[model samples]
Target: MDTMRERFVSTTSQLLDEDARLALVLAEISKDGFSAARRRHPDRVINVGIREQLLIGAGGGIALTGLRPIMHTFASFLVERPFEQVKLDFGHQGTGGVLVSAGASYDWPAGGFTHMAPGDVALLDTLDGWSVQVPGHPDEAEALLRQSAARDDRVYIRLSLQTNARAHASDGKPGFRTLREGRGGVVIAVGPMLDHVLAATEGLDVTVLYATTVRPFDSAALRAAAGVQNAADVVIVEPYLAGTSTAAASEALTDVPHRVLGLGVSRRELRRYGRMDEHLTAHGLDPRGLRARMARFLPGTPR
Candidate 1:
């Protein structure tokens, strides 16, 4: 199966063909993939070289003209580097565009810390009116991307190299999907962490909730899932920063007597440049590590 990034190039190319209002701005990140599309729609498919700020600025400018722009780049450059541009160009201006990003967290370990963006989601949380989607599979990525392209909203579709073994069915709506049911607790897995989370909680009596669209966080689904039990014990496993969605989960269950444990990439940087699997194990995001941690937090859960 193709990676999410590859699927993004193909899907966005199709969008450009289907919609005249859609425009794509890139900073030489995945320029090669959109070569044919660029030839087809030279005016719409733009490559702004290595200037990250300019990439967002151009996309925002296009949005100003009433054209739906999709900005593509590495996560670090797309969100972290041009954050000011993002805040001013899109949020402050009330402009709507889709920001599609690759190189999630530590997807390319050889690229070092500069390429990783474990805090991207956390940073976006500081801003308002932004819809964030973290798709675990290429099929989900394509679906979310197409959805974002159809609307003129400030949407961020996070694409990662890590993915689940299979794609879960979605109704193209922004909410969590219940994969398993139990009264012991609820495990909410975001994006690529679903497979590992499922494995970790295999024997544990917990309801597993899969989330692709995080922002406008489906508080209702969370509430409904937790409402069955007297007390809610929630565990959020994200592919980005560990505690990125913990606060959001807490807010969703504010009235209910509950506890939340956030799991994902650690703040402590791993100095060595290793494989992605190595990084996953180091961050305690692998199945073995997750099981150990989840077992400790969940009462009566055998390790």
Candidate 2:
């Protein structure tokens, strides 16, 4: 099974072949993967060197010319580094393009904290009219990428090194998919956190909701799930910053009494450069850590 980034290169390359209106902009992040793509469509496949801002600027420029541009880069460089350009280039300009990001949170721990972007989604939340998709599997990533390419919308497809054991199919719509039903509260797992979440909540009577499309957050599904549960106690397990979607959850269940526990990467950075699994355990995202936390939050959960 190839990683999401590898699948992205192959899928986007095929997309370039299929769609004349589609263009890709990069900042030397995944240039090697797109070597053949560049050769095939030199005019469309752009590499703007190390300038992150220019990468977005170039994509936005292409969008103005009625071309659907897909900008690729590390999450930190793509969203955090060139945030101002992202805000102005795509949002302010009122143009549509796809921003595909890799190096999610701490995928490459050896690359140091500069490469991590746990707060990328939170930062984008401040902006308006951006559709965010966090695919847990390569197949989902390819599906979402192709879906985004077909439309001229301001879409952000977050690709991560972490993924679930299997892929969950979608109906080409944005919403959460309920994986398990229970009378106890609800657990919403986003992107790569599904498998861990499943393991953590095993034997616990709680509804498990899988979310790949976060923005335009499927409030209806959340409300519906909470409506039947014994308690509206919701826990959101994201692959990015903890509490990134807590506020959104609260808003979704504004009228109903509820409590939300957001879990993911901590704001307190781990000083030591360790393996990705080490980081997951440190952040309380592993199955053991998650079970402990979930047991405490949702009553009647077995310890």
Candidate 3:
């Protein structure tokens, strides 16, 4: 399967070729992947090397100069490391760009803590007007990136190593997509967490909601998916930090009381180096772990 990172570079190159207003900025990480794009549009695709702050600053400068810039790099280095640049250069300065990040959460577990950034979205929540889309598959990633590149919004596209067996359209918009129907409650699956969510929720009496765009979170769609004003036992399974969307979910279900359980990379650091499965087990975010947690949270399920 083509990974999201590969598709991103490809689509970006294609977009840069087709659109004159598009520019791509990289920070040495994915520079090799974009060799062809850089060659085709040498001046547009700029790689500042290892300096994420300058990468974002150049993006902002390009945006200020009348071109939309798409910034790329690993998640931690892209968001957490040069966050001030993101804040001042992009946010405060009002320079808009499409920020695409790969290595979702702990996709690089062997790379250790410095490589992981589960709090990227949570930190993004502190800012305003940024669209966050987490695509579960490469096709979705391409589509989202394509769509965002066309517009001039402060957008963040998050790509990951994990993916589903198949790609889904789910309205082709940023909102709650109901894949399965039930009455127990709703399980909102974000980004690449869909596969695990599907496996875990099997045979359970609950509605499963899939979302590619979590920030600017579709509250109305979420409310509608629950089919009730007060959605009880609505679990949000994100690939990043746990409880990342609790506040948005709460505000969405404000009309009535609801119970929300946020599941994802836990706040606690394991302090041990391991693979993805090991991290999932530690965080209780794998299929088996999620199933056990759901059995307890979903009102009355057989133990």
Candidate 4:
């Protein structure tokens, strides 16, 4: 894990250009282990110290000058604080830059209620010309950053503070490929818990959509994956309270059998954890826990 962190950090530390800039952002942050990234890349990483609104304004300025800026802060502050600036800067001008948001839900239990922000995705999704991607793993994170940086305009990338199980990507699998093949049902899992979907369908005929970009979705690929031939059953999973990613996919491709498996901190369990790692484990988001959830979907299988 230390070596992996170093590799990611080295990759991101070298991102002076647009393409490398985005990948480096995700890799460097992951390697930084939360606070370390801010220290490592303070120039690129403008920490407004919980001021999302000011951060957005600064981000706009950086983007306006043709310098790419990747802003990091808590999800709640990001959504509640600087929406207007985001609209005026990135949204109105269709400016090109990247925004990396952390603390995506019950990730900051120590910070109390003000820090828990589950509605961040829902709010960001409504913005136009913005690409929203909730990556499920490190590899996907790398790929999303690379892709987003290559494109122009506002790109919003979300990360859960928790570490996700590595998918088969390390074995030379393309980050955006269809991970699983199911003839009867197609289950798409986005965000950080895609490893769960891959583990859950050990034997079942399920096609897994490992999408990094949540908004400006790959509708053509999604429709192809959930073709009319296999419309009887399809399941979509996300780490948010409401299955917005899955619901959005279903709405995009109607007449497909789609079920959303939303996993997040319920109000009843808000105070049960502190770090994102603990919250992920408690919410059954860990690899082992995800295997168990898959068993419920595919009974009689060894989880």
Candidate 5:
């Protein structure tokens, strides 16, 4: 099974080839993989080499020059390490570009906190007019990339090693898609967390909503599924930081008072490193942990 990152490299290169107005920037991560594209579009495809700050700046500059740019690197380097550049170079300049990041949450457990970015999306939330897409599978990743590339808005596509076995995007359509139906409440799964969510809500009487796009939050669809009265208890399960979208959830349910339980990576960092499953288990994001925590919030879940 090829990872979402692999698919991004493959598809993005094709985008670089097809669209002369498209440019790519890399900060040394996966630079070897894009050698051919770099050769083909030497002026458009730039490798800044360990300068994360310059990476976004170059992309911003390229956008100003009337080209859609895609900048790539690890999540931490792409977001946290050079946040000022992202904020000013793009946001201040009013220049839009697509920031594609790999290494989801604690993707490289051995790489530890410095290499991890559980708060990447939350950080982007602070900025305005940015569209964030966290696709569950590779097919959805390609589709979302192509969609974002066609626009000039600030787009952040969070790629990960974590993936679902299948793509759940509604053809090429946008917004939330229902995976399972019930009235116990809605358990919204973000990106790679779909598999874990499906496992957690297996026999529960809750409507399971799967979404690849989280930035827009799809309030209209959410309200439609959960109802305006907000009688049903809501649960949001994401692959990134926990409770990152609680405010959005609350805002959407303004008409009715409802309860929301968010499941995701904890704020505390795990000092030791092992496998991805170990990190997930530590954060209570594994299926077993998810099932346990969600059962209490949902009620009547099979023990």
Candidate 6:
């Protein structure tokens, strides 16, 4: 019986470039679906055997060898445990490797504190030249992963364990699309939260920046969008803490008024949730909350 993971592997194999070697590096640790995914991408996947430091370190080596390494690890292990390795081996050297970190927040209840990663954004934000891509769904995830693999910069791809809540329109727009084009406020979103931003556009005249490449953002597009917003109306949203987009936006648009709507466990409480969807909705990070917040800046739009 074929499964989603199987289909994902099948699709990936077809989409990958013939000469490109894409390796999936599992965390020093593993997840529920890790083994199955490895089995699917057998020849192309590399399991690092629970070594976070080695997981990233080896990626650097693979990059030097011209193979595209997608380091598949838990957010906690990748961002917290071997952060130094990531900075030294990947970030500083600017190796063209993709960090595929799953369970980026408090998604897995069984993983416990040691496995939950809530500080990755903060850690990466302090560094420069690192491109971050937070995809909203399987399609976006696949697209961004391929793009990152093709690039020669240090790329980080954050993944969520649960299915995404939104699907891109079939309107021929790339997986990453710009929703609203108003010059009022720029609402940059990643992950499933994009549904909220689009819904919130019911009556506002804000410009929505949908990113397929979280890092190496389109400077021309971002600048064009920022050129029209009010000084304080530009906002960014992510399923993790605001650190990722906030820092990126500040650097990208130094003269704009910027705010970030960070998701995941609050800085104060990390142990409170039954499911990923439930936790997101309870904290006003879901569609309703996004719509409400966006409404403030784009009052001219319809209800």
**Top TM-score prediction, candidate number:** 1
TM-score-best of 3 and 6? 3
lDDT tens digits, residues 102-136, model 4? 66777668888777777777777677777777766
Deviation in Å, model 6, residue 179 alpha carbon: 0.8
Write the residue-wise lDDT of candidate 2 on 36-89 in tens digits: 999999999999999999999999999999999999999999999999999999
- The model with the greatest lDDT is 1
Q: 1-303 in candidate 1: lDDT tens per residue?
A: 999999999999999999999999999999999999999999999999999999999999999999999999999999999999999999999999999999999999999999999999999999999999999999999989988999978999999999999899444578999999998999999989999999999988999999999998999999999999999999999999999999999999999999999999999999897999999999999999999999999988999
Check candidate 5 and list the clashing pairs.
Answer: none
Q: Which stretches of candidate 2 lie over 4 Å from their true place?
A: 170-172
Alpha-carbon runs more than 4 Å astray in model 1: none
The candidate with the higher lDDT, 5 or 6, is 5
Using lDDT as the yardstick, the better of models 1 and 3 is: 1
lDDT of each: 0.94, 0.94, 0.88, 0.61, 0.88, 0.64
Task: For residue 87, give model 2's deviation from the true position in Å.
Answer: 0.3
At residue 206, what lDDT does model 1 achieve? 95
lDDT of 3 by residue, 95-200 (tens): 7899999888888888988889999999999998899999999999998988898888799999998888887752347777889988888899997899999999
TM-score of 5: 0.97
Candidate number that wins on lDDT, 2 or 6: 2
TM-score of each: 0.99, 0.98, 0.97, 0.74, 0.97, 0.77
Worst 10 residues of 6 by lDDT: 1-10
Model 4: pairs clashing at backbone N, Cα or C within 3 Å: 12-24, 53-82, 96-153, 136-192, 182-205, 182-206
Q: Order of all candidates by lDDT, from best down to worst?
A: 1, 2, 5, 3, 6, 4
Give the distance in Å from residue 293's predicted Cα in candidate 6 to where it truly belongs.
Answer: 4.1
Off by over 4 Å in 6: 1-17, 28-44, 92-94, 162-176, 229-232, 255-265, 292-303
Per-model RMSD to reference? 0.7, 0.9, 1.4, 5.1, 1.2, 4.3
Better of 1 and 4 by lDDT: 1
